[model samples]
Target: MNRKEFLAKLGMGAAFALTATCLGSCSSDNAGETGDVDFTLDLDAAANAELLQEGGFVISNKVVVAKNSDGEFVAATVVCSHEDLEQIVFQNNIWRCTAHLAEFNQQGEGLNANGSNGLAIYQTELSGNMLRVFS
Candidate 1:
């Protein structure tokens, strides 16, 4: 190839390589844990207004807290078991990872190939507008 053509190809290849590297490393590895968790949310608080609606959810303290369609509270780690990425959220009354699309049930059991490791679940209790999530 001509010198100019070769240099152009080399530059394009370098750009592609850099893009790939950045995409891989730019994500946070904040998923997979926070041992011995024990926290509470006041249902009457504006920050937790979602809890008042069935099938709504919020993420706090590295945990994804949700109110199922049945108006019951459930909790799980805000991490995908497959890649340990903090992309877990509640949708359709179950846990889903936006990064890799891993899915888990309320019981923290994997529901798909990408969720093979399952998820870490927490115990929840509700009393007088207070919701407690514990390990």
Candidate 2:
């Protein structure tokens, strides 16, 4: 190839490489979690103590933390399966995704109006002042 054509091709290739690298790093890691969702939060403080109440929920970092009727903690992704919207809230012990009226149980087994897959649930361990949530 001519020198000018070779240089142009090289520049295009470099641009493509840079774009690929940026896109690769842009993929959502979602709250600094690895492939596994092992994360911990200190919920024993007065500010966070609201999570212990029945039907209470705290949403942060793409995850929803809620307490069931039995005062047990449950964790799940806040994204609604119906439209992938992050409008999840807890009310009356049920997780309702306000984006499209999708609802899930304490075990995250409920479904959206379209009958698609339910919310993704994470296992929670509440001990002392630490709450560890994982899947």
Candidate 3:
């Protein structure tokens, strides 16, 4: 190839390489988490609202729904990773384990640094005021 044509191709190749490297690094930072887990609860037709308001309405052997600070609802697993005790308590927009006092935010993010992990969160959907959490 001519000298000018060779230089043009080299410059184009370098630009493409730089673009690929930037995109590669940016995507790698977000690779850890796939997505949030989901769990769904089917409340019985005669389910008592008062019981739900009191919290600790067990959806199954693995899940529970509780009201957050806004009175909106959220769900998480009742199983505590620390001691496998079902001690999840809802108060002030957070879920706390009464057994060991491990705290987690509404989105299931660990709020403490005491080696206590966050509760597992389930994605919620509302259908006519009925909240559905998928597992």
Per-model CA lDDT versus the true structure: 0.83, 0.69, 0.58
Q: Against the true structure, what is every candidate's RMSD?
A: 8.2, 14.2, 17.8
Error of 2 at 113 (Å): 2.1
lDDT by residue for model 2 over 1-135, one digit each (tens)? 999999999999986875665454333313222236777778876756778688777875678888888888888887765546678788788878664456777666655432145677788897787988888
Candidate 3 per-residue lDDT over residues 20-128, each given as its tens digit: 6444432212111224445444444455253255443444445667765465667777665444567766656677766545677777776763214556777668776
Structure candidate 1, residue pairs in collision: none
| C-alpha-based local distance difference test score of model 3 | 0.58
TM-score of structure candidate 3: 0.55
Q: All candidates' TM-scores? A: 0.76, 0.67, 0.55
In model 2, how large is the Cα lDDT of residue 15? Answer: 68
Candidate number that wins on lDDT, 1 or 3: 1
Candidate 1 lDDT score relative to the true structure: 0.83
Candidate 1 has what TM-score? Answer: 0.76
